[model samples]
Target: MQTHAQIDGFDPERIERDVRRWLERAVIGFNLCPFAKAVYAKHQVRIVVSDASTERALLEQLGEEMALLRDTPADEIDTTLLVHPQVLGDFLDYNDFLDDADALLEALELDGVLQVASFHPHYQFAGTEPDDAENLTNRAPFPILHLLREDSVDRAVAAYPEPDAIIERNIATVRGLGVDGWNKLLGD
Candidate 1:
């Protein structure tokens, strides 16, 4: 099965360093986007994400837009399954729980197929960040993950072993918080 491991650029060398340092922890290889450009038009970081729904014509259109829009180039080689942050309602709670990467990863229901892993993050060094302001981290824990049923792991593995249903469920959840709809981007 083909999977994509999409990541944004903060610092390419640092990202590679962290990924290498934590290679033992990663569940799957990543298709890292080496030069991620901040989406100036939109608040979110623009990435070349792909899914089952993105095919043929739509894919072509997105390819064109990605060229026109600010974007990062594909970087990591030989990796599938997107590794990303799970959106949480509260940022403080999210920051507070990052202290225990091992505990957090241990909590995941990874078997042979399931995987949980991430690298240390590079911050902008703003005092308002509340944390160290300059620490490498995965920003691991959040109560939103607590909502997931452990049994969901099996279903997720059956679907997409790397990211699986778990990530999709979370994405649906955050999108639900907005009036616009994830369907516009992710598809129906």
Candidate 2:
């Protein structure tokens, strides 16, 4: 659990309201796009991948569906070559992927490949420069794609009541949720 301040799409009351509002009208599907590259973090931009038919055999062998990418593309590397058709991983390991991201991008050399990382937006940051809007949206999770569809929200509830796995893993551990309804008090 964590205590987050009110921002754009996420509302304090509903928590995910801010995220849901922005994603409803997005055109491209993304899981999490951090504005920063392993240096600055200020917001959360998360989206989901809807297809697995474009990844190459190597990326698919990893069994990942969505990828957590930085909003700022590497000035030198061209990612189009890595986009392919294959299986993919759904989870995003923000910490692991963001660390030394530039050096790791070398794997993109393979053909027909895509990337997936933990659903974390540590790369997202709010800046003062007016000309930086383009950089901001690069990794922002605006339109989340659903492989299963919105109707399935309830199906997940029955299978993960009280958050058996996914929720427990996604959110932080020692967060200030004590001020935001600490689950420990309820013995959850």
Candidate 3:
């Protein structure tokens, strides 16, 4: 697959490194997503650094990534993180783009097979303030379109006890950590 590093003057390797650190330290270390640790440890997570500077370009890349994930076996690639640092830097813009991301999933007829989850540096929920500690749960090093297999999600949720409590547990975890603690954890 094309890294598109030359297109936007972004160093894909560096971007991938930063993302990996975030995934390992913030996501896995903190247990934000219980399902993440196993797939990551198994080397089934694919991180793609996109150089797309426009929403259109990024959307196109998203479609391709979704198809690739659908076609690939679960053992080889359980999930993908498409990190697009150039486009949708603003959280508002990034939030709006998620609708289009979902639409693209329907268009590709992969709606039931795959799903998209969002993570951004400034990810604020609808009711929460920008500085709310809970938002940290979804925050990442950059704007990320996390693609996953629906069947995998089902299996994980089924295996984990009280799967519905994960969100509240995550919020409490980050709230306890607070902003400074969170930054320290991420080595920011």
lDDT per residue (tens digit) for residues 49-100 in model 1: 2221222333243334322321222221111212223222244533443333
Q: Regarding lDDT, does 2 or 3 come out ahead?
A: 3
Point to the candidate with the largest lDDT: 3
Candidate 1 ranges beyond 4 A from true positions: 1-90, 101-152, 159-188
Per-model tally of clashing residue pairs: 10, 31, 0
TM-score per candidate, chains pooled: 0.19, 0.22, 0.94
The local distance difference test score of each candidate is: 0.28, 0.28, 0.93
Candidate 1 to truth, TM:
0.19
Candidate 3 backbone collisions, by pair: none
State which candidate, 1 or 2, has the greater TM-score.
2
Error of 2 at 108 (Å): 13
Please list the residue runs of candidate 3 whose C-alpha ends up more than 4 Å from where it truly belongs after superposition.
Answer: 1-9
Sorted on lDDT, highest at the top, how do the candidates line up? 3, 1, 2
Name the lDDT of candidate 2.
0.28
